[model samples]
Target: MTKKSTIKVEEVNNQIVDWLKSYAGHSKVNGFVIGISGGIDSAVTSTLCAQTGLQVLCVEMPIHQATSHVTRGREHIEQLKKRFPNVSSVEANLTSVFDTFITTVPNNVDAGKVNLALANTRARLRMTTLYYFASVHGLLVAGTGNKVEDFGVGFYTKYGDGGVDLSPIADLLKSEVFLLGHFLAVPQSILKAAPTDGLFGDDRTDEDQLGASYDELEWAMSQAEIHKSSLDFTGREKVVFEIYTRLNAVNQHKMLPIPVCRIKK
Candidate 1:
């Protein structure tokens, strides 16, 4: 895997800010809306939105998250509001909402699958909240998923975090995102903190679910080229390919395009 980066983080930040400005202007939307999860991706994406000098609605939609996670999310949004006049934020604690969904849904699944489904439901709930505010305010829902999560590993939930009008950092790798975060002066705590989806309710992290670190995932992603090449892969390359294939299988559904059936005349 290549350790050196050709992309300039500062330039990327400026370009994304500019893109957001132009997109919102052309689309005639008043501003951008983002769900702040206290992870670096949300922190950087929201900061980039703030940098655009346009109205940015940062919502903290916590669903039975850890106290620390909720606090971090709230504090980050507050910081954005204090620093950027165009930034505004609100909290949508969906504990009751989620509980209602769980209790109301059909109780026909096993315990582990039920937990996974509920976690994903949290993401969909946040997506619903974001679009609700966007519709009310004439804004676009801004997504926080980075390249590794969005494209490489497809770690995001479909129509959940994946449902957004724009993904400002979707092209940025996890490592590159941290670079942009550091450049944008995002809080050091957020930068260094362990990344989590906050979807699993209490304290489960992304890595815990994926069974690999971002660095390893990134490295594993780089092996796709080698996996497809006609040239032979050595022992290490094969091992990495195995990990990549296993992790990537989890995203097969995410990678599938919307199913369409042909209507025969």
Candidate 2:
């Protein structure tokens, strides 16, 4: 059974928008740049940023092999443009860059680690593009991670997709994100599509990697929140214990600052 989210979608959206704008102001950012994955999270984030009167540059960085979500990205961008005339879309193909880097690396590395390295590389590539555009246009990088993904599972690459100047929906859960999308009138198709990171040749979904459905994970996260145990080892007890424990242990890299030693002056 899935635990219901307690947040009011409209209230969360308004609060996030106001908070994001204030963050932008404090950082002296004139606009925002974001990468849209054709997933609901990015769509909702883009919509909120646009509605806030920020000049939004939405980039679609699709590898040549994974073109399935390209059309969806286009439609999302179009909807954004209707509300934010200043919104712009760009296509950045990452195949050549990924290929060149992989070819140069020695094959002695573990294949699984190599694959993760490549995925992280692609994420960094997208971030690099956003940063360059932001620097040129005087905009901030708008992040699209939700609380379920970032806080619960820590499902983000460090300094990769994890890099952001401000996150608009960092506090909202996955279920709440859908509610916010519905309240904002986001396209129904995008809101309903299975969430994916678009990182693999097979076009993998987030649930496949996470070992559970978003509904399940969200429930576990909510329980963890109430229990104040970042790991929710209740209900399904064992399975939840394994998933929560492993994720927290392995993904701790996502939670900490790079270690720096204090030198005596």
Best prediction by TM-score: 1
* TM-score, cand. 2 vs. native: 0.91
Which consecutive 10 residues in model 1 have the weakest lDDT in total?
229-238
Tens-digit lDDT track of model 2 for 40-140: 99999998888778788998887654555887788899988887787888878777877887788786878898777777788898889889888989999
Model 1, 27-122: lDDT tens digits are 999989999888899999999999888889999887777888777777788888889999998888888999899788997879889888888899
**Alpha-carbon shift of residue 218 in model 2 (angstroms):** 2.0
Cα TM-score per model: 0.93, 0.91
Clash list (residue pairs), candidate 1: none
**Residue pairs in clash, model 2:** none
Model 1 spans with C-alpha error above 4 angstroms: 229-240
